[model samples]
Target: MSAALMALTGHAEDRTAAAREWRAAAKPVVGYVGADVPVELLTAAGVLPLRLAGSPRADDGAGERYLGRGLDPAVRSILSRLLAGDYGQLDGLVVSRDCEASLRLFYAVRELRRIEPATALPPVQLVDVLHLPHHTTTRYVLAKVRQLRATLEGWVGHAIADADLTRAVVAHDRLRDLLTEVARLRRRQPARLTGTQALSVVAATTALPVERATELLQRLLAEAGSLPEAEGHRVFLTGSSHDSPDVYAALEAAGLLIVGEDHDWGDLLFHRRVGGSTELALAERYQHNGPSAARASIRRRAAHTAEAASACGARALLCYARRHDDGPPWDFPAQRAATGLPAVSLERQPYGALDIDARAVAARLRVTEEVAR
Candidate 1:
């Protein structure tokens, strides 16, 4: 692999490494727990915005105690890390009320900080942007974005100017364009990259500094055409957003190439850029950009899934939802009908190894392919 690809993959595998390095360098680092948080606002405030990922392998007994066993596994893992002081170095933390589990996480962290003053939790703020596509909802989301900017300003001890936001927006737009190119490469015939590699690159973008991430993406794209082609059944993944590439890696190892996905961690993350340099523009863009399982209607989600699958030349669809992450699974039936393709629904899945018969899935997909032919 090229050095750029290697660096991005490493950063994705170790999500906190880059943030720790930045913190050590005396730079302010703020962590966000959901996709809805405006990263541009954080960037404009001159702090590193790191997206937190749960470590599925972590022994999070504390998380079980605080969050209980019924919550989403990824959320529990994140709570465990917070309780363990894994993010003690962060200057601030933003938790979005994008989904129920993440909202619960915000409440738990806030209460924990209030009761246990000795806990090393960073100052936390909640960005609650409602996704209803009405003018009232848009106004509400815009107000929330402004509040987030104020909170970030307080953290950095300075007002975030429009110039700063404009510069940040421009930088992020460039990053988004570069990522779009990478996505195009993934959809190429005889795929230029593996699903795992594509996912790693996406995850790394949120973990690393924007400039560094953009540079790495540029380097990878320059060499992507020459990368060895990946061979497998072209598949589209939907349902729960993936924090790690483990699932993609396993599925690809089982003879499937996930060419596209409609999840926050994948294509939906960069589906739209900040339309303008202002907070209202950012709020409007996020609120209206793409269908999210947490906020969008089932029909819209299904339509997006079908459109994305067709665009990527996927022969089949895989809908995998994690335990307690209920929103995505509700769309599966609609998605199955809309796509009109062979589909598999792996619902209530765990965070780790997936614990499914991969070979059986591969065999079934092969049979479906033959039947389609």
Candidate 2:
């Protein structure tokens, strides 16, 4: 791997490294918890947008004490870290209503700050963008986006001009374009990069500065042709979002080459571009981009997953939903039927547990392929 790829992967693995560096330089950093938050607005507000990711290694006992065990493990992990002051450098935090877990996380954080005054929690904001495709939904989301802009402006103590937003939009659009090219490379006949590596590359973009992320991506793409091609049964992943590449690494190690995944941390992160520079355009783009497991209908989710898997030339599908994350499992049956491919569903998986019988999975995929042939 090139030095740039290594650096980006490092950032992905160490989620808070870039944010800490930025804070040490006396720059303000605003942390957001989910993919639904409009990062471009934060960039336009003259603050670094730090994407807050959860760790599988977090203390589940402590998390359960505060937020209870009913929440997704990823959300629990984030809450645990916040309680431990792991994200003290954040100037503010934005929680999106992208899923039920995240929305509940926002409420939990707010109540914790109230009851536990000594805890080092940042001021939090919520951006609720309803996902329904209707005029009222569009209007509501546009208002929410504008409201987020106002909140960010209040934090920076200055107006975020249209020019600032325009520049930010352009930069993000370029970054998305570069990521799309990287996706194409990953889908090549013999993938130039493994799914684990691709997840790291995409996750790093959320942690680093946009310009730096784009530069690193360009460097990686330039050096991609020289990387060793991955070999295994081509597979598509659809389930809970992956904050770390541990599962991908494990699956790839077991002879399953993950070419694509429809999770927020992977290809879905840049699925849509801000078609225009205006707030309304941004709202429309996100509200209608790809079908999200949490918000879109089962048919929509199934069609999107099928299209993405076919486009990537995947031979099989793997649906791995974490315990307590209900959305993905609800869509699994439809997704499997829509794809019309050999599929496996691993439900109620524990966080950080790589106990998947991946060898058996690989064998099954091979047998299915031979039978089809």
Question: Could you tell me how far off, in angstroms, the CA of residue 350 lies in candidate 1 after the best superposition?
Answer: 0.9
Candidate 1 per-residue C-alpha lDDT over 1-373 given as tens digits, one digit per residue, 9 for 90 to 100: 7778898999888778878888788889999998898899898998999998888788878888988988888988888897787765888889998888899999888888899978878889999888887999999999999999999989999999999999999999899999989998779998888888999999999998898899999999888857888899899999998988888888999889999999989999998888688778999987886688988999999999999999999999888888888988899999989998888788888885576877677777778767867
Q: Each candidate's TM vs. the true structure?
A: 0.97, 0.97
Candidate 2 displacement at residue 44 in angstroms: 0.4
lDDT of every predicted structure (CA atoms): 0.88, 0.88
Among all windows of ten consecutive residues in candidate 2, which has the lowest summed lDDT? 352-361
